[model samples]
Target: MILAPYYFNEKTNLSEQPYRNQKRRLEGRSIRDLPLYSQELLDRIRLPAERDLNDDPCWLRTYYDPSSEDSWGQIQDYIDTKIGGPVTVYNDSSLYNFGSNWEKIFLRAPQLLDNTCLFEEYEEYVEEALEEGIESESGDAQHAGENGYDPVEDENPWICFYSEYLFRLAAGHIYIVDEKTLASEGPDAGTVLVMWYDECGRAIRYYREEAMHAAEIANLAPCYLKDYACWDNAEIGESYEWGAPLGPPYGENRREASE
Candidate 1:
């Protein structure tokens, strides 16, 4: 599964703060009393013709089936055209940490253990570790301790490691968009052109195809990939915004400077 950030339409009432503020109950102040809450603001906010308000931007999750011959072909073509040739696995010795149980599992039964099983096993291990408070000599455990594990937090390195492991198993290597490349190339580069293969080359390139916009706003490029069980159920060719060049306010300054 590929997850991409939602691109919001700026020329919409939903995108305005006043419209969003209407949903909230202002404790002491009237909604109209707020700054920028005026008829002028409402008049200025224009909805796109024939566009549904419900069609607001949202993070998109697209699933592809590697099992299907047709789907697999498309996936391969995309990797080849967009991501370039896969890096030699031997070049990056750190790709598969021999110490990881996930790596061990992959070596043992790469076909048998799906994503769900890996997640369950990871959760189980975390639970066992937390319950027992066993400070092991293993690198992962030591790293987890140093990072400070919190059950509620998604930022846990342990969880991130497993997530990447699952992605790597499917793709064989991951490519991350380089920061310098983004700054230099801007949004026109897209995620494809700016990405570099991760030093740990176990799998395919995983990136946010529309991350240039993200970089413009947040100054960060986020990337993630997941393997799903219900790949057959998802609609093919429904993953919109893949490989599309980023829109305005992203590379505008850089382009202007160059021009």
Candidate 2:
């Protein structure tokens, strides 16, 4: 999902006359010709990377017209035909949006405040389970207690609780549609069509009004949490073993984990 500017043959000057003469046939050009045709021009025109049309958010333009609301159905239809199955279209707010993004939302620090009531319930459950250690006759509940009853030590307890609440919070936000349903009938709006097709192309989870652009999701979420959080008695240059420093790029332990 991370995209960078892919370069084309720099010696080819496409803007002058040869390419402009083929304007009518531009739609017929394949994605392989994009660097030689489109992005070079976009960069020549000085558009930012987010609007570069080659990136994820803008890349949707290659599939359907963002300006057209009806394109959603066209998207579903194309997938259906390719997959040879009935296509189902749901809005971005539908039940089909559950995925990695939903998990990230719950795992973020801001979620601790967003779902306070659920966290309180988790705390109560943990307290009760710890108190009822040996005598709890419930099979699964008793089994959970046998593992030393440490929520922090045995990551499963909090994971189970967080996952349940995350599912509840994410309901009606995930959307699903049939494969290749994207180009249902045909598009009249002149939006780009699919540049590439994979038989195993997974359904993309999207938001209605928000693009969930990579920069916004990956960079902004942690900073937003830092801004709203309390920083009492915070010391600088202290190498904490758990979390990163209270600022943007919250990834102090990231390299350690990867290593």
Candidate 3:
């Protein structure tokens, strides 16, 4: 969903962590207390009811600021702390460059998908590529073919070709979340959270699977759908589960069941 841009009323003050403070302020408050932009985003996401919040792993939310230099590091730290090791970051398709590169990387190293790797390998590859003046452009692969260099023949095609994108993933430049992996692996394997942010980088939200997970990261409780103004309008039949339809079931299966 296309979310409206959100801007902070106050000026940017890096002296203190403004985003951290904002996250703290949002805790324990009704969704009604949230700014209109935040409320609108939450409404579009359609959170579950308060009664199901604890039982439903999909209803949790967290907070983080991508604009902050330290925020990515903290996210990595959180994932590491949860999993006891570094995670193989997966980017949303919305992250065009990272997503495309990830597809290529997966083709070359399918075993690495959703698996941890030594951070040193990513770092070393990046340093060597930079020293060699290897262009990260998409056209570079085509150019290499003309020069008699075939990347497919390489033992480590991911390292030989898309190492730059791998570096970005390891460095946390791209946002990463995979729901299925999180579900199968459990929180100890690492929890993934969806993030939303305004174009101006003034506001950010982390949609998590547990309130404690969110609170631990933001150091504050998260706002819930119960606090939203539209919560009262939610239909009794609405499942509020992630990826579930908003209304009564009406697919072919429903017809067959009724018959």
Name the candidate that leads on TM-score: 3
Residue 185 Cα positional deviation in candidate 2, in Å, after optimal superposition: 22
**Predicted candidate 3 versus true structure: per-residue lDDT over 213-233, tens digit per residue:** 532333222123323321212
Give per-residue lDDT, candidate 3, residue 23. Answer: 39
Question: lDDT: which is higher, 1 or 2?
Answer: 1
Cα-based lDDT for every prediction: 0.27, 0.26, 0.31
lDDT of 2 at 124: 44
Where model 2 places Cα greater than 4 Å from the true spot, the runs are 1-157, 176-259
lDDT of 2 by residue, 7-117 (tens): 011212222122223433565764456667676775554324322221111122212234334655554344444333222222333222433232222221111112222
Candidate 1 per-residue lDDT over residues 1-259, each given as its tens digit: 0111112122221221222233244345543564765635643442221111221111111222223234323333443344332221111123322322222322322221222222324434433432232223123455554534555663333332233322322312212222322333445333422121211222222244444332222222122213321111111121111222212122232234345
Ranking by TM-score: 3, 2, 1
Q: How do the predictions measure up, each by TM-score? A: 0.17, 0.18, 0.21
Task: Show model 3 residue runs off by greater than 4 Å.
Answer: 1-66, 91-247, 250-253, 256-259
What's the distance in Å from true for residue 139, model 3? 62
